[model samples]
Target chain A: MCGIAGRILNAPGRVGNDLVELMDAQEHRGADSTGFAVYGIPRDSGYILRGMGFNKARLDSDLEEFRLLLKEHGSDFLEDPTFVTSDAAHYCARMVISDPKDLAGWVKDADTISDSFEVQSCGRSLEIVKDTGGAVEVADKHGVRDMIGTHGLGHARLATESSVLPNASHPFWARPFSDVAIVHNGQITNYFTWRDRLHRLGYRFLTENDSELIAVWVSHEMSQGLTMEQALKLSIKQIDGVFTYMIARQDGIGFAKDRYAMKPLVVVWQDGEFAAATEEQAVRRIYPGESEVINYDGPSITEIWGVGNRRAAA
Target chain B: MSEIVIDVGQRPIREINEEIQTACKTAKPIVVRNTLSRHNLGIGLPPGVDITFEGSVGYYCAGLNTGATVTVEKNAGWAVAEGMSDGFVTVGGYAGMSCGAAMIGGLIHVKGNSGPRCGVAMKGGNIVVEGKIGYQSGFMSHAGKIIALGGAGESCADALWQGEVWVAGEIDSLGVDVNVVEPTAEEVAEVDAILDPLGLVDTSRNWRKMISGQRLWYFESRDANAWLMI
Candidate 1:
């Protein structure tokens, strides 16, 4: 079992803190590793990059190659990349870089060096902070509680279909799709089948985790001219699995449940604010006071909750 | 008889449950307060005990209950009366998925709607939902009865085995290998007997009683006959 959460504030406020509390209440669901995808205030020129390097010892060399690749793509780092190193072999980096001339081409080239250095997210607003620990531990290590954003997503992974590596954790960013990320609660049964199809179509996968497949699959559909609502509804028929996943862009959050309705999603969307989690107890942490919960417990269900005034590419 | 109040604000569930067990022995009505939708609040209470939770409760609130009269003032999380042999579980508001899962004997009255699989795999007892039962409610029950007054969600009463699902209003869809049959007057009276105590018996209503088509049981029966004689 896994715990997935999403929070959309009425305005750009302490969404990271609320998301941390949401994940903390559901740590028991899966404490294998916790991750947060916080959408900070959107930038106009530079994209915020969250990446992980497999070997902390070779961080300098790995980043040097990364910088060269970025320069080759007509984008250069605005500042030196900041690193968060730990006792583990892997290290996390945060960088601000000018937008690449071709975003998809740069991301495809970036994945060539993904064996050693992998970019987890690149968005004008979204910054994914994840590590191998509980919610409190990860939040403290990455200063997640202080992040400000209009919306965000959180995940507590159990490592059902993949290894328990930090980079394998969620929320998985839809690669080459800026500001789009997903956190899923159920396994995708037909993961390998669709992964092969998407891979054949030039989409790259970072982890063997089935949830990563969903991020790319949904984004792939949307890229093919389907709106977020249309893609979410289509996933119920095309994706063969028992899943309830919440995907977020800069503007809002959208969710879809599989046909079996195996996974549960509880929500409190009131007063222009929205909070959803795999369980009601987790959402209670966000709305401590009395608030009616809407249980998305039906099969083949999809919903889209628009965030503040931000406009997403959709 | 005086009433006893128990607070369950962020305290360890084990300690709170132990206190509840102690309070049950007093045979006085017990009220649980500040229940922040926490899981595993009350489990396996003995006979003659009466308890009421103030607000929403998390998963398995009155699970494994044995003859206690339990009430949740608001919503209840998954498997509210799961694995119960006997009890009275009343959710004043909505009850989450698998509301009476694997229950043997009891009555679970959900005033509000129920989540998916309302009486899944129940061997005996009855579940009365005033509002609509959610998707695939009464799934694969070995026995027992599930009555829904306010319609039912998709795939209602799917793949049953001797169990019965009675609906008063619209059924979105029927499940595979299900046989919808007209209820005899005697069966309706028996169902009314179960509902009379809760003041929910209404005549002049159209009833659709669903049962197993007996197709799913045939293969299982053939497999059972070939069991090793160990």
Candidate 2:
């Protein structure tokens, strides 16, 4: 079983740190990998891109080729790309870049170098940090606790359907869709079927993780003019599996459960903030006192919690 | 005669349970405080002991109970009294999914609503919910009684086996191979006996007792038409 969590603050505060606490409380669910999707303050100009390079030795050449491809898309690095390196061969990089002429086209070109260096998330406010370890280990490696964001999502994966590669960990950024990400708790049985269909439609999948497919699938539905609420409701019928997933956007976070209600989503909303997790104990870390919690325990349920000035308790 | 207070704040579950087990030897009343909705509290409790959780409890709070009297001041997470042979468990508020799963003997009273599959796969026990029961309340039961005073959610008593699901209010929908029959006076009296201790007996209510239709017991796999009936 995997663990997933989401947090929304009244303002841009320590959402990333709150997410870490949520995941850490549920580390026993899955220690195979830990990941976080932090949504910081939205920027109007440059975009922040986070990614991983397979070999730190090839960092220079891989980035050189990556820079030329960005130039072809009429975008250049606004600042130098910084790397987080260690004894392991793989390293993570964070870069701020000017706007590309065509984001989808540039993403297609970027996937060409995905074998060596892969971009995980690119958005004006979203930054996804993930690695192969428990919550505390990955948090210390990536500095997730200090991140500032209005809302975010977290995941602790057990690697059931695919190999336990670090890149296969979630929350997966919905590629070609900026500032959108998802963290899922169940296996999507028909993901391969939908994956072939989406692949024919020119959507690229970075990993075999089913959560990545759902990320892109929901975003694709929304791109086709479905509102976030409609898309979440449609996923319950369209997707075949026993899953409970939370999809987070720049505005807020939404969730959908499969027909059978195989997974649990316990939520506590108080004082204009929201906290949700696969288990109630995880959310208890946020509200230590006796508080009312809503269990989305029925079948085929979906909800959207908006992050704003007014109270969003539900 | 005094209450033995146990704090369960961020402490380890094993440690807390150990203290509880030791206190049970004293035969004093035990009260758990600052639960914080943690899981696996008060598991495998002994006989004749009295315990109460001051707040909402996480999964398997009074699981595997053996004749101990347990009460939660508020809601309980999944499988509150699973695998218990004998006990009296009371959830002051809601109870999560699979409330009394796999229990052979016990009486679980939920004051508020119950989540999906309230008595799923339960062998023997009596589960009484004062409020409505969620989807598929009595799924695949071997032998037991699930009584709901309020309405029932969709797909109630789906695929039940020998066990009886009695509802007094509106049922959203019946499940596959379920036969809802009018209970005889004796059957209604049996159910009333189960509810009498909880002070929930109502003589003016209409009862719908659900039992298995036995269609799935003898299945012909070669006949694809039989499979389409679901």
Candidate 3:
């Protein structure tokens, strides 16, 4: 079980501030990792920000190495890149890129050269951070308490089948494709079968968690021109067992329940926006009130609006 | 005495429900002043003329109601008329599990989805779910009629005893000892009779009559482990 929060903001210059606060409040959902992706208009990308602990000396050195590596790749790092630290290992970087095509290569290279700390794109131009601790500490350390974005997704993880390192934290980015990530609350029983198929198809995988496989599988399906709804519907037949997954992309977010609806997914739609969670409390923590909540049973589809609709709701 | 009003606005459940019971001594309608009340609200009554919960109740509300006519303006909880000896439990929303469990007599009607085990072991009365039911509904049911308008989950009518299960949607899995049999002439007449009251005879033909496999309930000995035999 993990905590997932985010919004499809109607008004926005940037939505980082709201996204950070939402993710930060749900830290206990996952003590091992905290990750988020912000889908913004005009700029779309992804990042895997890892925690480097309170060792300012080590982090400073790591930062230097990271910067040098960026320079070696012929990409200039952004000035005043954000880096916040907490008692629990936490660090973030704000990078600006002119070329979206180079994202997959850059993320793969970063993962390869970063030693054991893995890196991958969560959709295009999205950013993810997974550290060894809770969400609040990480938010305070990273100054995410005030950061907001237009359309963003966050995950607080409880590691079930992956390493406890930052590399294993969600939202696990689907490789090669930026702007696609997922924070799932149930097991994907067919992960191995799908993983093997993806592997043979030359799609790369960076983690061992079943959650990661879901991102890749969904991304692959989307790449094949299946609408997000179609992909989700097909997946229900392909994957078995109880699950409630919130898959986020640069364009939108989608939630699906298993055929049996064994697990829970609650949503509250108010004032033209919707918030969802595995439990009612998670959504209430962010938008407090006696809002009408929908308790979905069995194979309900909810697609969160993307940044394209930003001006409409505003 | 004036009628008591228990406001169950996210208040502790036991407090509100128990208070209603005590105030029910006046035989007046104890209004639970909330539009949304979750599970097990009005249950296990001794006797009362009339009581109404203002809002929708969660699962198992008004369970085992005896000698009362409970009307809910919204949805009701599971087992709405569970073991009800005599009463009328009406829901504007959905009624859930064991809507009339082992009930002697009563009426329960839901406007939405009901979970599994509906009308389980119901002795008498009619339970209606305008929506669907989950798996293992009416397991070992002794008697009663359960009507479902939506698709059923797996293992429907499992080990059913005497009773009728009417479904309007496709069945996922039929329970053991339970086989689809042609509706008897009496059964068809009964359906027509029931539908006539509700003013719904359009799907009369689509409604399939289901009953327990007599082998399980009529066995003279438990020596064969009758459950598996059924």
Candidate 4:
């Protein structure tokens, strides 16, 4: 029970603010959390702006000096993270770039950072920020209300069996690998079997949701130097039961439906542009023009856009 | 007086229904062309209209029919007259399984082989399969006459009541509580009356008639031989 939408434009460069407007219609699909990944690198460095916090007063006073310390070490920090309290209960911050080598180094210094946080530039091609809340709240606070991109993916989670926590919110990004995420619909009945196999391969899992297992499987295959499409095509065979999924890799985005075509995946591709969603209404609401719209049955591969225009491998 | 000619040109059934629903409000017949290999031709016909699907239908062709006459120029799908009431469905080709299943009041004519359970739990109307039928032809027929042109499958007649069954083919086996009985010439004429609309008559002096001994509804065993195995 989630909504996902993404579009690929032929005249790429950057999309302005319309992305948030498109996602706003599907806010009900995910009430617990909201987020988006902009396909650009943040310029400022070392200043990790933690957007939403319960104790703003405490974090304001406590982290002020540490924020200054980062600026003192040839690092420029911007910490005025804004949270759109009216709509979204989230916040966003921009960090300055100082020491280029120490980008990942600051992540290990957990003692200096108060909150349980994470910071890493995935593939140096994408920036990911996700938290618990609705779309308006997240977009208002993160300043994504006016954000746009040529390629991106978003998920609004409807937690069926799992608790509504930050980690459970999608689009789930696989750890230790950047620029790879997955948003899925339908259950993985054979999750345990795959989980056991992944554990044997020294891969760690973050959430109990079966959807997360797919990220690990794909990441493992990618680590072997297999391209994103190659890895996903291979992983589809090992998974059992009905499922329709979309994978956002560093270069491109891929979507797949199960063998039986049990789940739904509607795609509309036209004029060198493509948009897909769980329902036709979602796609129509955004693109709403006459185009060739078709339902994705089982065992079909659609590669909409990628790093260099690679067709989705069947 | 507008004639809507529907030929197979990649138009989905949903699109056709929109036109049919509008035409029914003004009383018109939908003339369908190139119905061969077209699936779900006249499924779930709307009220107050007549639809003549000009060719064979794929699967679940005329299911849940209500207040409409759907005459197929060719064969029909599985469960052709499933749960239909107050309508008439005629198939010129072979029908699959469970024809007129749980039907209330409708008429279904099949010109070819019927798979299995030709009329299961038929409450009203009549189903006449003009060709051979598969096993368990009428497993639990409650009401309705199942006229078979060719032979019947194993267990031809099971536990049935109220309705009548006439099989022209050889019965391989009998189901539980099914009785074979001699039919009077007057009763034979009544069976022939149902086929008059479709113009199918077998007057070769070699017709066999079978009926439930009315024991299913009354629950009495006057005759030791539930089936008159002649």
Each model's TM-score, in the order given?
0.97, 0.97, 0.70, 0.52
Q: Which has the greatest TM-score?
A: 2
Docking quality level of the chain pair in candidate 4:
incorrect
Candidate 4's displacement at residue B18, Å, is 15
Clashes of each: 0, 0, 32, 15
Error of 2 at A282 (Å): 0.6
Worst window of 10 by summed lDDT in candidate 2 chain B: B221-230
Return the top candidate by DockQ. 2
Candidate 2, superposed: residue stretches over 4 Å from native: A309-314, B222-230
lDDT of 2 by residue, A292-314 (tens): 89999999999999888322331
A192: Cα error in model 3, Å: 3.4
Worst 10 residues of 1 chain A by lDDT: A305-314
DockQ of each: 0.78, 0.89, 0.13, 0.04
* lDDT string, candidate 2, B3-37, tens digits: 99999999999999999999989999999999999
Q: What is candidate 3's TM-score for chain B alone?
A: 0.79
Tens digit of lDDT per residue, candidate 3, span B103-192? 878777776777657778888877767778766677777777877777676778888888778888888888877766777777767766
In TM-score terms, candidate 2 sits at: 0.97
lDDT of 1 at A73: 96
Better of 3 and 4 by TM-score: 3
Task: Between candidates 2 and 4, name the one with more favorable TM-score.
Answer: 2
Tens digits of per-residue lDDT for model 1 on A10-34? Answer: 7788889999999999999999999
Higher-lDDT candidate among 1 and 4?
Answer: 1
So what's the TM-score on candidate 1? Answer: 0.97
